[model samples]
Target: MVESLASPWRHDFPQLLENPQLHYLDSAATALKPSAVVEASRRVLSEDYGPIHRGLYPAAERATDAYEAARSTLHRFLGGREDDCLVFTRSATESLNLLAEGWLQSVLVPGDEVWVTTLEHHANYLPWKRVCERVGATLRVVPLNTDQTIDATQFDDLHPRVKLVAITAVSNVLGVALPVSEIAARAHAVGALVVVDAAQAIGHQRIDLATWGCDAVVASAHKMSGPTGIGVLLARRSVLECTEPLLVGGGMVDLATAEQPVWAALPSKLEAGSPNLVGAVAMAAAADYLSDAGIDRVESHVAALTHSASEALAQLRGVSVLALDAPERDHGIVSFNLDGVHPHDVGQIAGELGVAVRAGHHCCQPLMQALGVDATVRASFALYNDDTDVDALVSAVENVIDVFGVR
Candidate 1:
């Protein structure tokens, strides 16, 4: 069993302690925030709460500085260059919608197609579908192989009409880690922009926007052990310059006259209204905590747990684990369905046994339809998870399956 390195922040997260009965295996859906993140939110809400970029009071100045500092920290965390733009939104879904409506809608013309994988979450798929419908663009999917991995050869087979490729770095349901860098390079060769949904990969993997060379990427703060109601959008400045604003209000505009109007630069153009100031500060603190803990170590720990989970779960009769049977490495998500049993029932059983796992389509109905299953039980891991958690999950699953029996 691989152990996590000594991390000071590890001591600060009280939720890490096992409940002797409860095991949290749903970090992919949402993670428990550390004390630092929690205190950061409280401090923002109580100590220095005000409208940023519009006030001159001391409290407002502090709020403005903290908010912008969060931006800078995220920029650094994402390895964004000076020419990159980071837009704050409510969630990863909102960020993707902003891109589909703002950037892709304005740039992609009629008959142009957007290439996406079948493994995408609904958040990535629906927005693009809407944009394609509105702009008279086509929606083409890159089908997955029987192993539940993307067919890399399909990229070359893409139609010349393809103008943008929106993909997930790691699938929330399939747990497959997609070949995003290769896809980005190939798509760019055909003059197509790439928008990656890194919501499941951000806190678990090292994402270098420069190396990934995508046009834009989105992630939610809550999945990264931060606060909710705040998501991040990272894009190339040139690409960001070509997009329109989704929301028009407060600080996003530079000058507004009845006859003529001008919007602010890159980021401000995309970020409208008061913004999630407290969420941003807390997210930045969470990012800092992850950075200090060493993302590589954190990733390794979670990967180990997931790998162990696959092995242990497979030992149980009438159980099947996706991606593990394949030769490819999967992300932290482990999705499965027991024979002759509903996923919701399995989830309920596990929950009663003190294992918190996600049930249902996991917000990926399209993918779920493709898989020929209505729902799946998914157990995802995080840095705080250890082998004991994996053992607990395996034990809980065995108990659950025994009650239902194999079909």
Candidate 2:
């Protein structure tokens, strides 16, 4: 049976709604925003713009309410409790850095172990490596199995020396969703902390942070269909208490003294200077938008689209889909390499064909080295994508093979 997979929410994105021919397959890079989120952002910039927390004026109060409301929505979105602290940042990269500096650096001893994976995005990997370098901690990188899952043998003995486990919810290149809950269980069993980079898995999967048992979680707004220049760091109170301020400025101070300075509360101390207030409100609107749509439905929608695309692409001669044997392992992304063509050429040809797919390392050069390929073409799906988008991708890949005469 041919799957008549059409996204019911396709019309939600103004960009896709306007241009039917433009098949956007690069959503894993950054998802398209829904009108609801766009409108909320517009209202923030034009109508409700003001300083938050410090302003006693009407506009300031409204700004403060909207900003805090964004936090409240995200708290619930991440299945956060009252004790959890949510701090806004410029991007997930910054969030990871903040944890590395504020929390990880503060707690890590010279002999501690910070476990990472070869599958991590650079944002997750580099921070830990640099932090380990600074603190004299050992950075242990766990290799991946053939199917892009973590190798079990690497965890033969979960030691207490492992101070932190930094990993991603989904591999950006392979699109594989790891067993975070299980990983966290192992980490916690050894009395270690787990910090997850959920930048790719944010909207595609419903993240119950408590259930996952992560000490801290980081994500970006633009990746989840919100405005850019804003991201978030959600951490447990214990982690926040241990974490010092990454950046301290105007909005984050409790009391400024000529002799000595006093720090603000948990989140404020962490969030210094002027935040992206407009982006925060817009991101909350995005959280609300995804909440209303239901994440389970979105996950299923993307999974189906991904499986179908993976099958179609794998059928092409001289093409190999990464982790094709374990399609279920990945979510919302399908990556592959043509036997004879460069990924750049494939990506360029695909782009010329009106299908937008990412053709590079996907910011996972370490992962590419693990896969033994310099780069792979990545077709990432979103909630608003459907079978037609997959069709365009398949056709574009076929074009690449034909252009290169690799058949």
Candidate 3:
């Protein structure tokens, strides 16, 4: 087991410093904001702020520059092409909803199918399902392997009725990183649009849009140590031109008339109403912070912590880890169930001990149904975590076992 006893970058998070006893392992839900990210938000909201794409004053110009510059930074971060369309939204949830309402609703017809995996968070699944329901299209679920990992071969290229395949780069519950690029290739062979939900993979992995060959992608900033209430939708220019915008008003219109409205081009058309200026700056700062820390180093460090946690949990007689037997799949998360103990109870007890883990279905009720369980305890890692955090989590789980008297 490759383990790091200490994290070099842990000092960057002020919350950890403020409460040294707090072991926050729920990074899969939302990461703890680093000082750099917090400072970025503080500076944007308190100072150095201005209106974007409106007003002729100096402050407005600077605001527009900062907002667009943040977009450009994220575009470069995703290794986007010149032809890619990057639009900001409220959250990854809104981005997915936009695709479902703006794009899929136009193309889906009776007997056509939209595909999603059982591992999806409700945000990815429900929007498509609702859109498909309205359009008389079917929502087909791609099943998981017996080990609960996604199989790349299950994409099923021969299925011609499938118009889109929406999959996640990482399973939030299992922590198994799927071969989305491989899946994208197979889906592309059949001329299917591929949309990846990168909300979980945003901070954990480096994403290359060109290499993934997906038509579009969505991610949330809060999940990656950025401020909440802002996310991004990135798509091909084709998707940008063809799909209609979900929200309409102020900034997105080129010309409005009595009969019809002429929409603005690319990103401005997609982003309607007032933008979250502070969120954009903070997210970009988070991207820079992660880049400086080295994504590969972050990946390795988290893998080691996950491996240690998974192995330790497995050794306990009553604990059942909901992960693949393959240790290589360990990617900053370890979710499990303790025998005969409710996950809520486990979570509550863990929190009391200052080991904060997520509990319940994790917004993946379908996945829970597949696993024959109602809920689970999810402990996820980040760059700020170390071996000590893993030990605290294990110790808390042991305390749960003692309290519940589970064999």
Per-candidate TM equals 0.95, 0.97, 0.97
Off by over 4 Å in 2: 151-156
What tens digits encode model 2's per-residue C-alpha lDDT throughout 1-407?
22778998999999987888999999889999999999998999999999988788999999999999999999899878778889899999999998898888888899999998998999999988998999999999888887777743566567999999888898888888777888888888898889999999997898779988788899999999998899999988878877888776787777887466788887888889987799999999999999999999999999999999998888999999998876345598899999989989999999999999999988888888888999999999999999998888898888888888997
Candidate 1, poorest ten consecutive residues by summed lDDT: 1-10
Q: Report the C-alpha lDDT of model 3 over 184-287, residue by residue, as the tens digit.
A: 88888877899999998888688778888888889999999998899999899898788899988989998977469999988899999887889999999999
How well does candidate 3 match the true structure, expressed as C-alpha RMSD?
Answer: 1.4
Give the TM-score comparing model 2 with the true structure, all chains together: 0.97
RMSD of each: 2.1, 1.4, 1.4
Q: Candidate 1's error at 54, in angstroms?
A: 1.1
Residue-by-residue lDDT tens digits, candidate 1, 266-342: 68878888878998999999999889889988887777778888877877887877666655555688998888888
Candidate 3 local distance difference test against the native: 0.89
lDDT of each: 0.84, 0.88, 0.89
TM-score ranking from best to worst? 3, 2, 1
Give the C-alpha lDDT of model 2.
0.88
* Superposition TM-score, candidate 1 onto the true structure: 0.95
Q: Candidate 1 overall Cα lDDT vs. reference? A: 0.84
lDDT, candidate 3, residue 158? 33
